[model samples]
Every structure is written in C-alpha cells, then in structure tokens.
Target: MNAASLLHLLQFASPALPIGGYSYSQGLEAAIEEGLVTDADSARAWIVCYLDEVVARWDAPVLWRLMSAFAAHDAGTIAQWGGCFLASRDTAELRAESVQMGYSLSRLIAELGVADTRALGEDVTLPLAFACAVDGLAIPHEEALLAMVFAWVENQVLVCVKSVPLGQVAGQRLLLSLRPEIERAVELARRLPDDELSNWAPGLSMLSMRHEVQHGRLYRS
Candidate 1:
C-alpha cells in the first residue's frame, strides 16, 4: 500500500536479497545426484511436486498463520507458530537452513531500522520470522504472501539452473512456466485450513536427509 510497505515487500521478495538462500539447494542437489531431476522435464516435474504437495500443503499455510499472528501482535501465537515450523522440518539440514536464513534476514531487517524488529529477538524460524517482520512493517497480507511465494520460486529456479545445468534462458522459461502454479500456490495458501497444515513431500525430505550424509556434495543442503 504505502511506499515503505511496497519497498519492504520488494526487499523481502527479491532474489538478490542477502538471506543466504543461494547456498542451499532445498534438496534439489540430492535429487539431481539420484538422477531424479536430470533434465528439464524432470526438473519441472520435481519442482511441481514440491510446490503442490510440500510447500503449498505444508509451509505456506504456516507462513500465513505466522503473518496473521504478527499482524495481531500476538507474541504467544508467534512463538507457537515458530515451534510448529521447527517441528515441520524433517531433517537437520532443512532445520538449520531455515533457521540460518531466518536469523540472517531478521538481523538484516533490524539493521535496516524496521520498527518492532526486536519481536524476532533471536533464533527464529525462517518463515515465521519473515512473515512477522514483513507484517510488522505494515505490508498487507496479499503483498506479503506474494513476496514469500515469489522468493520461494526464485530460489528453486536458481537451484534448477545449477542442478540441471539449464541455460539462463531455459531457467527463465521454466520460471515463467511456474506463474500459474505460483498463483495456485498463493490461492491454496490463502484457503488452507489450520488443521491441514502438513508437508507430505517424503521424497524431498528424504533427499534432504540423505544430502546431509552425501559424499562429494555440491550444496549445503
């Protein structure tokens, strides 16, 4: 709405934002290593499954609840949401990745002089802290959700570029192809019932767990 809110949303959503997002592959590297995502078609399918089942069904709804809690200034609810987010992470790498990025982003927001930043005092979960900071900064729910999903997609595409060795054009095209899916993810996120917030991407989670023990690794996760 306001210029500051718009700027905050853009800052949060930008692929170039310094949240250490590029360092983690979200288990895509393991998927690639296992030959599960060896080509453009496979990459697209893997990404679609991740978005539709894992993120849309699991992470997005938690983020929405975090945003709601932040908007309401409910510290207790926010803490509960953070616990839930942590529990949802099935692997050590996945858990560490989320917390690391969240800590970095929360520190970044504090340095940027966003008000009420201390609410995310220390060691907050990535999605919860992110949702809280942006919502605390007065960004509307729709804009915050859009930014969150956009960031998620951008990070995934970046992973695809490296794992699949896709050219920039190809990566952009793949990203373009995801617009419809992104819209659906956003819509599904908005309508998700509180009781149904669970990520069922067993393959993705297993890949992440395996990646932790992977030899000759190319990614942190």
Candidate 2:
C-alpha cells in the first residue's frame, strides 16, 4: 500500500477517529449484566468467541466483500450487503448504533474530500463505509483487512475492560492472546465468498435485544 493509503487505514482504525465506538459496547454491557462475562478469563473467552464465531464468521467477510464492491463502484452490491448487515442485527438498538456510526463516518469522509466519496454517499453502514474509505484510498486488500480486524479487536477489548471492569494489564494481555485468532479471521476473510456471509451469535444478539429495554445500562447496545 502507498503511504497515503496506509495512513488512511490507520486513521480509520484509530479509536480516536470519533466514530462513537465508545458509546456502544456491542452487547458487552448486557452480557455483563447477565453475568455471562464477569472477570478476566470470562471476558477473554467471550471476546474470543465473539471475534472468532461472530465477527469472523459474519462481519469481517461482509466488510471484505463490501470493500471489493466499493472498489468496483457497485452501489447495488453495497446496498445489498448493507441490507444484509442491517438484517443480521437482531435488535433495534444494534441497528441504530451501526447506521448512526456509518452515517457519521460517511459525513466525515465527505467533508475530508476523500476519494470515491460520491460513490460512498451519506447512507452506509459503519463497516461498509469504513471499507469504502480504505478501498478508495487504494489500500491493499490484505493490509486493509488486517487493520480493520485489529481495530475491531481493540475496540471490543476496550469495551470489555470498561464493562467487565478488567484491569488494564489484563485487557492488554487478552488482546495479545487474540493475535492468533486475528490472523485466523483475516485468513478466513480472504477465502470467504460474497454469497455466504452470515452471523450466528444468538447469545450476543439476544443480549443486544434484551439490552434495548434494559432498565439500567451503561452502554448503548
């Protein structure tokens, strides 16, 4: 990847990118409320399963395919994938969280005058918008995929730390241990087909649904 593309990937993946990632725990809050994740070990397990089965099996591959579609300037494919992404989320809060973040990121990209902004438009999901931004910047597929997955893991780790109250050191350690899983996810993403993208995290989805009406909550989803 060129330096510009690399920089774009870094910026997109940054926690400070202002995508409101901190506001949504991606169901971690509900998991904690239900005691599914209470301590470092349980948190690590939850994250691992989530990244491997949920994220890898679902979002990563969808994002990768969306990147290809964006690179081709295929609005139809983007919209189809966007619908699938929206449908995959089993809760209203989760859907709102993703669309809001995506819309915000698209606006940011437009204001920044990033390439292919016209193709990206204002209505896009967070992951699809992210893929479009990086692909538009001409980042190599492998590097972009890896960076996105890493950012996702980092974000989930931060959420776990806050929700489960894991120590900073423990959180970092959990992230370190996920390196192999990250590599696996990247590899799986590369091989996944566009037609076979699906997510099956019933437990996580259930928590997200339950969280929408949760009497007391610290995170949005």
Candidate 3:
C-alpha cells in the first residue's frame, strides 16, 4: 500500500485515536472477576479464545463484508450488514459499546472529512465506521483487516495488564505469543464464506450479561 494509506490505517488503529476503545474491555473484566482469567497465562488463554472464536468467526468476517460494501458504495448492503452486526450483540452493554464507538468515530470522520458515514445511518456500529474510513482512505483490504485485528489484540492485552495485574513485560510477552494466532485469524476471516460466519460465543456472552449487574466494574462490557 502507499505510505499515506498506511499512515491513515495506523492512525485509525492507534490507541490514542480517542474513540473510547481503551475504556471497554468487552467482558474481560467480568471474566477476571469470575476467575476465568488471572495472571499472564489465563489472560493469554482468554484473549486467544476471543481472537480465535469471536473475532475470527464473527467480527472480522463482518468487517471484511462491511469494507467491501463501503468500497462498492453499496449503502443498502452496508446498512443490512450493520444491522445484522448490531442484532448479533449478545447484551445491551455490548450493543451500546459498538454504537457509542461508532458514533464517536463517525463524528471524527466528519471532522476530518475522510469518509461519508451517512450510508451507515444514525446507528453506525464500530466496524461500519471503521470500514467506511478505511475505504475512504484507500487502505488495502488485507492490510486493513490486519490493522483491525492488531488494534483489538493490543487493547485486550492492555485490559489484561490493568485488570489481571499482569506485569508490562508479561503483557508484551503475551502479545508476542499471540501474533501467529492473529495472523491465522485474519486469514480465516478473509476466506470464510458469509454463511459460515458466526457470533455464537455463549460463554463470553454469558459473562457480558453477568457484567451488566456486576458492581464496581472496570469496563462497560
């Protein structure tokens, strides 16, 4: 890809992008409280499961489809896929997180004049906003997916570091160890047919539901 596109993709995925990604753990905190994740090893396992199961099977593929829809300027397809994505959210908090992040990114995209998010309508989900921006910036599809996966992996690691009380070095090590799996997931996302795509992560979804009423939680979901 061209340097400008690469830079834009980096900026989109950066932790400092200020879309509130850092504030949400996507159920990691609930897992920690339940002792499903504790210390480096458990944290690594939890993140790996999320990557392989939820992301690889669901979010990444949906993102791939959304990016294609944006590139084609198919607003109808974008809305259809976006709605499907939102409906798949297992809990209220998870749905809110996606919408809130999407709204934030939509506003930022408007300010930068980088993408026309009107196609996504008012309730744009995070992947919809991201796919639109990537297409608008002319980021290549495979690279865009890689960047998205990397950003999520890094954020999950950061969540583990803070909540699991894992050392920075251990978190870094965990990130390194998961690189191969990340690459594998990206590939799976690229090749998986639409019919095969799924968001059937019952265990994780249950944790998210439990997190809704959990007192003194660190994450929104």
Candidate 4:
C-alpha cells in the first residue's frame, strides 16, 4: 500500500476514467419513469437493494474472480469469466453497457502503456479489463475490490440524483448510508464461491428492457 499504488487505484476508479459510465443508469431511469423510484426515500431504497442484490451478489464476485485470473496471468480464465459475466446480464442493454465500457477501458489501458492486454481479445468486459489495470498496479485483490465497490456506489448515486430529480444533499446522504455496505459487499464477495455467482435481477431486467423502448429517456439502461 505505497502512496503510488494507492494513487493508481484511485485514478483507475475515477469517474473521469472515460468509460462512459455516466451514460448508463442500469435501469434506474426506467424505474423513475414508472414511479417505482419517485422520491429520495424510494430512490435510496431502490439503490440499496440493488447494491446488495445485483452488485454484491453478482458484479463484485465476478470482478473478484477476474482480478484473481489477472493476477495469475490466466487468459483462459479471464475469457471464461467474461462469458459468464455477460451471460449474467439479463437484458441486451445491460450486456452492451458492460462490453462497451470494457472496450473503452481496454483502449485506455493500452494508451497508458499499461500491460498490453490486447491479447485478451476485443471484448474484455469491464470488470475483467478493470481488474487487469488494478492487477498491473500491484494493488491487492481486496483493496481493488473495495475500489470497485466504491466506484459503483458513487456512479449509481449520481444516477439516482439525476433521474429521481433528488437534491444533491439527498444523493450525498444516500452515498453516506451506503458507505458501510461497501465493506460488507467486499466480505460477501470474498465468501462467495465461483459456482454460486449468478445474476438474478428480474425487476431490473424488466426495467432495462422497458428502457430500450422508453421515450424521452435521459439515460441509457
């Protein structure tokens, strides 16, 4: 945990990292449209459940495995995990969001003269590509997982602030409430076996599918 490695992890998780993360609400926008997340309380509640069920249960664990594979330099493992990760996305938009972000991050990594992970193929999903960057920095897996969880929480909070039309204070409050959950999420992901990880957000999938056809949408699903 030298200062330089810490800085690299922060920069890797920076919202300005240019992965187009702000563009996708991951179905929050559709939920807002349907009045499922009308106010600050509801918005906060929705995101809390989403963090525990969708992110902690699926994305973080997938990311954990990806980080493990990257650390071992196991390209086959990375590719296999990428397939499973995409399969977990219940909707087409969700799948595209992961792939597009993954591609953008991969190019950014190459541009930074990070390890030439170009051999990981054209479609290295976000978590895998992100793990490649974090592993390159020599950040430990646990620290990297925390960074991923924080970044996701921050991004989804912004999604709520914009879509739910909540004030900045409410969004900040929501983030504060979720801070302790990041450690819990990291712990949950660690204890999760690879065979047990699966995506199971039917409500989110329906919202995302609806978002594909929703009119006057402010964000992509």
Candidate 5:
C-alpha cells in the first residue's frame, strides 16, 4: 500500500476512530459473568474462537465482498452483502451494534467527502461502511481487511481486559498470539465465496441473547 493508503487504514483502524467499539463486548462480558472466561487463557480461547468462527468466517469475508463491490461501484452487491452482515447477527443487540457502527462510520465518511452513504440509505452495516470508506480512500483490499481485523482484535482484547479483569500484559499477550491468525483469517476470507460465508456460532448467539436480559451488564452486546 502507498503511504496515503497506509495512513488512511491506520486512521480507520485506530481505537480512537469513535465508532463506539468500546461500548460493546459482543457477549464477552456475559461470558465473564457466566465464568466462561475467567482468566487470560479462557479469554484468549474465546477471542480466538470468535475471531475464527464469527469474525473471520462471517464479517471478514463479507467485508472482502463489500470492498470488491465498492471498488466496482456495484451498489446492489454492496447492499446485498450489507444485509447479509446485519442478518447474520444473532440478536437484537448484535444487530444494533453493527448498525450503529455503520451509521457512525458512514456519516463520518460522508462528512469528510469520502463516500456518500445517503445513496446507500441509513441502515448500513459496519463492514460495508468501513469497506466503502477504504474504497473511497483508494485503500487496497488486503490492507483494508487487515486493518479491520486488527481493529477488532484490539477492541476485543481491551474488552477482555476490562470485563474479564485480565491484566494489561494478558491482553497484550492475546493480541500477540492472534497476530498470525489474523493474517491467515484475512487470506482465507479473501478466498471464501458468498456461499462459504458462515455465521455458525450458537454459543455466541446464546450468550448474546442471555446478555440482553442478564441483570448485571458491562456491555451493549
């Protein structure tokens, strides 16, 4: 990637991008409450599964499709994959999180003259909005996917640290261990077809639903 593209990716992936990622754990907090992720090891395991089963298999591939569609200026494909992304969310909380992040990023991009989400309507999924921004910024597909996964890894690790009460080192350790996996996930995501995109995470889905009703909550999803 060129320096300009690299800088755009960095800014888009930064934790301070203000897309409200820190507000949701995507069921991590509920897992902690249920004693499923009590320490660093358990937290790491859960993150790996989520990254592989949920994120890599579903979002990353969808993101790849969205990036391609955006590059081609195919609005129909963009909307199709965007709907697929939102529909894959198992619970209301999960769906809302994606929508909210999508709206935020899309609005920001529009305001900055990057991409016009108005034509795409308001209920954009995060993957599409993010992909649109990268496409608008002329970021390469591979780098954009890496940036997206890296952002997710960073956000989820911080979630574990705050919700599971893991140490800073533990969080950093999890990030380190997931680095190779992230790259592999991006590569696999690139190769995946629309039919191969799966959202099979019953455990995560159950946790997400349980979290919506759980008394003590630390996250939005």
Candidate 6:
C-alpha cells in the first residue's frame, strides 16, 4: 500500500471513525449480564472464542468475498453476499446493528466522495460497506482485513471495559493478548473456502436473541 492508502486504511480502522461501534457490544453486553464474562480473563476468553469461531469462519470470509466483488465491480455478487450476511444475523438487534452501522458508513462514504454506495442499494451490511470503502481508498486487501479484525477487537475490548467496569489497563492487556488470535483469524479468513464458511455460534446467537428482551441493556446487540 502507498502512503495515502495506508493512511486511509488507518482512518477507516480507527475507533474515532463515527460508526457508533462504541454503542454496541455484538452480544458481549448480554454475555456480561448473564455472567458469561466477568473479568479481563473471562472477557479474553469470550473475545477469543468469537474470533476463532464466528469471525474467522464467517465474517472474514464474507468480507473477503465482498471486497473481491467490489474490486471487480460485480454488483450482483455484492448483493448476494451482503444479503447472506444480513440474514446470518442471529437476532433482530444484531441484524439492525449491522444495517444501522452499514447505513451510517455508507452515507459517510457517499458524502465524503470516497465511494459510490448507491450501487450497493438500500440495504448494506457493515462488511459490504467496508468493502466498498476499501475499494474506493485503494487499500490492499490483506492489510485492510487485518485492520478490520483489529478494529473489532478494540471495540469489543472497549465494551468489556465499560460494561464489566474493568480497568482500562486490563482492557489494554486484553488487546495485547488478543493480537495473535486476530492475526490467526485473518489468516484463516484468507484461505477459508466459501463452502466451509459458517456462523454456527449457538451460544452467541442465544445470548443475542435474549438480549433483545433484556430488561436494561447497554448495547443494541
């Protein structure tokens, strides 16, 4: 990647990007409420499991395919995979979270003249929108995927720190420990074939579904 693409990649992956990632736990808040994650140790386990199971096996592969589609300007393939990703959301809140953030980033890309999101149509999954931005910014796929997973790790750690009331230092420790797993997840995503892609996280799915009715929640999913 050139300096410009590298800078754009960093900007896209930064937590400061206004996509409302801080507002959602992606099921972690519910897990914490249910006592599944209570400390830095448990939080680390929860996040690692998510990375190994869902993100490596499902999200990254879908993101890879979407990026390829965007690079090829294959609109039909983009829609196909985007719909699959949206449908894979295990709960209404999860689905809505994807769509809401997707819309936010989509609009941001359009307004900034970064990408033509109109071709993505009315409904956009986060991965699809991100893929669009990566194409527009001329970011290399490998590095973009790495930043994407790392950004997710950072956001999940933030969620744990806030909701579990863990210290910021503990959160930082969690991020440090998760580096290898993040890299491994991205590597797995790179080689994962389409037939083998799966999002079979019943535990997470159940927690997300129950989160919809949780009495008082800090996150949308």
Candidates' lDDT values, in order? 0.83, 0.82, 0.91, 0.85, 0.86, 0.92
Candidate 4's TM-score: 0.96
- List ranges where model 4 is wrong by over 4 Å: none
Candidate with better lDDT, 4 vs 5: 5
Q: What tens digits encode model 2's per-residue C-alpha lDDT throughout 40-147?
A: 889878878888887887888888878888778788988888778877777888888988899888888878877555655544688878877876677777888898
Error of 4 at 91 (Å): 1.4
lDDT of 4 by residue, 1-221 (tens): 88988898889889988999989888888988999998878877887788889788889998998888888888898888888887777788988999999999988988888767767776678997898898777887888899888988888889888877878998898888887788898899888987777668888889999999999987877
Per-candidate total of colliding backbone pairs: 0, 0, 1, 0, 0, 1
Candidate 1, overall lDDT? 0.83
lDDT of 5: 0.86
Please provide, for model 6 over 71-190, each residue's C-alpha lDDT reduced to its tens digit, 9 standing for 90 to 100: 998989998999999989878888889999999999999999998888888778899999999999999999999999999999999999899979989889889999899999999999
Model 3 bad stretches (over 4 Å): none
For candidate 1, write residues 93-125 as lDDT tens digits. Answer: 998999998888888877877645676666677
Taking every candidate in turn, the Cα RMSD to the unseen true structure, in Å, is 1.4, 1.7, 0.8, 1.1, 1.1, 0.9
On residues 5-118, what C-alpha lDDT tens digit does candidate 3 reach at each position? Answer: 889988998999989999999999999999999889898888888999999999999999999988888878888899999999879999999999999999899899997766
Task: Rank candidates, TM-score, best first.
Answer: 3, 6, 5, 4, 1, 2
lDDT of 2: 0.82
Model 5 CA RMSD to the hidden true structure, in angstroms: 1.1
- Evaluation by TM-score, superior candidate among 3 and 5: 3
> Which runs of model 2 end up more than 4 angstroms from their true locations?
116-123
lDDT of 6: 0.92
Write down the worst ten-residue block by lDDT for model 5.
115-124
Candidate 5 versus the native: TM-score? 0.97
For model 2 the TM-score comes to 0.93
Query: In model 3, which residue pairs have backbone atoms overlapping below 3 Å?
Result: 27-221
